[model samples]
Structure formats: C-alpha cells, structure tokens
Target: MNNKAFEVLQKEAPEVSEVWQQFLLKASALDEKTQNLVYLSVLSAFHLENRIPFHVKMAKMHGATRDEVISAVLVGLPALGNIVTTALSVAIEAFDKD
Candidate 1:
C-alpha cells in the first residue's frame, strides 16, 4: 500500500487510481484468496519481484498459506523458466512476516 508508484498515481492521478480500484473490485469474480494467488502467479511470470511482497501479504491475509505462496511463485516456472524463481524469495519473505 506504500508503494511509490501507487502513491504517485494516487497523488497525481487520483481519478485513474480510483477507477482502477473500482475495476478490480468489479472484475473480481474469483474468491479473494484465489484471485490473490492468481495475481501472484502473474507477477511471478512477469518478473515483477518488487510487487510480489505486497500481493504475497494480501494473499496471506486472504488465508493463503506459506506453501500456497510458494506454489504460486513456482507456477510460472514451466512457461517462464528461472525468471519466476526471482520472485520466490521475495514472496516467501513477505509471507513469513508477522
């Protein structure tokens, strides 16, 4: 929630950020935990390691276990290979936090 890009978007383009949040809410047909898990996989696939910790925490808040977080990070390994591994440590560190 304290991400710099998100802060900038909220400060400089509040309307766009609000609309994006609305879109996410409206488009979420999957259960929250599942959606967060899917988001983790996509983040991993894209090598979005910086974003992983936030989503990993969200996933944990939604009842995702540590193993689920690990699996989500590795889910993209087949298609993306080792690039997905870059997110594993980041995701685990986030998930393991209190």
Candidate 2:
C-alpha cells in the first residue's frame, strides 16, 4: 500500500491506474484464493520480495493456509531453482503475521 511508484502513477496518471485496476478486476476469473496463490507463485518466481508480503497476506485472507503459502513459493523451485528461496521467508513471515 505504501508503494511509491504506484502512488506516483495514481497521482500523475490516474486514468492509467484506473484502467489497470479495471483490467485486474475483469481479468481475475479464478477464485480469490487461487488467484492469490497464482500471484504469490509469480512473485516468488520473479523474486519480487517487496511485493510478496502484501500478496501473502491477501492469499491468507482468501483462506490460504501457511503451508499453502509455503508451497506456492516453492512451486517455482523446479523451474527456477533456489532463487525462489529468497521469497520463502518473506512469504512465511507475512502469512504468520496477525
């Protein structure tokens, strides 16, 4: 929520941000938990550490268990290798948070 780039985009190009939000809303065909799981996997694969916590929390809110969050992070290991480990701790910490 404190992402500066996103904040700047919303401030400077509100229309573009609105469109992106619309796209996300329309494009999310999967159930909320599944979508969050897919998103967590992508974030892990890409090593997007900064974004992981938010999505992990979202995933948990959508009924993802801590073990499911861990599995989601590790799901990319076969394809991408140990690089995904960088996100494992962050995701777990976020999911464990109350």
Candidate 3:
C-alpha cells in the first residue's frame, strides 16, 4: 500500500518529491517530539502551495506556540524574499482561523 503511494508520488514529481521524501526521512533523526519546530518551519515555507490549515493544526497538536508558528512564517522571508513571505503571511492568517 505504502509502496503504491510512494510510486504515485514519485511518478507525479520525480525529482523534487524524491528530494523532499529523503529530507523528511533524514529529519527523523531529530526525534518526533523535538521536530515540531522543524516541521512548522517547512510548513510555513510551503504554505502558499500546501495545506496551511492542516500544518497549522499539526503544529498546534504538537504543542507549538502561536508565536512559534508565526516565527516560522517570518523565517521564510529571507529565503523566499518579501513578496513570497507576504503571501505566506496571508496563509498564516487564514490558518489562524480567528
């Protein structure tokens, strides 16, 4: 079942998806309990194209502070540049569900 899932993903995005899959697997070295920050950071970076609410919920479930999540979004500013960061900020606000 999982192999089928992976095959589908690889077929859909061979190069980028493979890199992401490997990166995620490598992240396991940090331990699940302590990886919330890392996950939240990536979640923020992927916010424009990914499921923001889902990741936000996961971050909350992992005991992440709202500030921590916002900081994650802010951290993307340098790498993503101002415009992309602004787009991500909008996603963050939407995810806040407030």
lDDT of 2 by residue, 14-56 (tens): 9999999778867888887888888889988987889988888
Model 1 is weakest, by summed lDDT over 10 consecutive residues, at 1-10
Mark the regions of model 3 whose C-alpha exceeds 4 Å error after superposition. Answer: 1-27, 31-36
Per-model TM-score, in order, reads: 0.83, 0.81, 0.51
TM-score of 1: 0.83
Candidate 2: worst-modelled 10 consecutive residues by lDDT: 1-10
lDDT of 1 at 65: 96
lDDT of 2: 0.88
Give the Cα-based TM-score of candidate 2 against the true structure.
0.81
Number of clashing residue pairs in every model?
0, 0, 0
RMSD of each: 2.6, 2.7, 7.0
Q: Which candidate number would show the highest TM-score if scored against the true structure?
A: 1
Clashing pairs in 3: none
Stretches of candidate 1 off by over 4 Å are 11-19
RMSD of 3: 7.0
Q: TM-score: which is higher, 1 or 3?
A: 1
**Over the stretch 21-95, how does candidate 1's per-residue lDDT look in tens digits?**
889968889888888999999988987788888888888999999999999899888888899898988998898
In the predicted model 1, the residue pairs found to clash are: none
Q: Per-residue lDDT tens digits of candidate 3, residues 1-98? A: 24466678889979977899669868687744246556556655655434455556666676766777677667767886664465455446645775
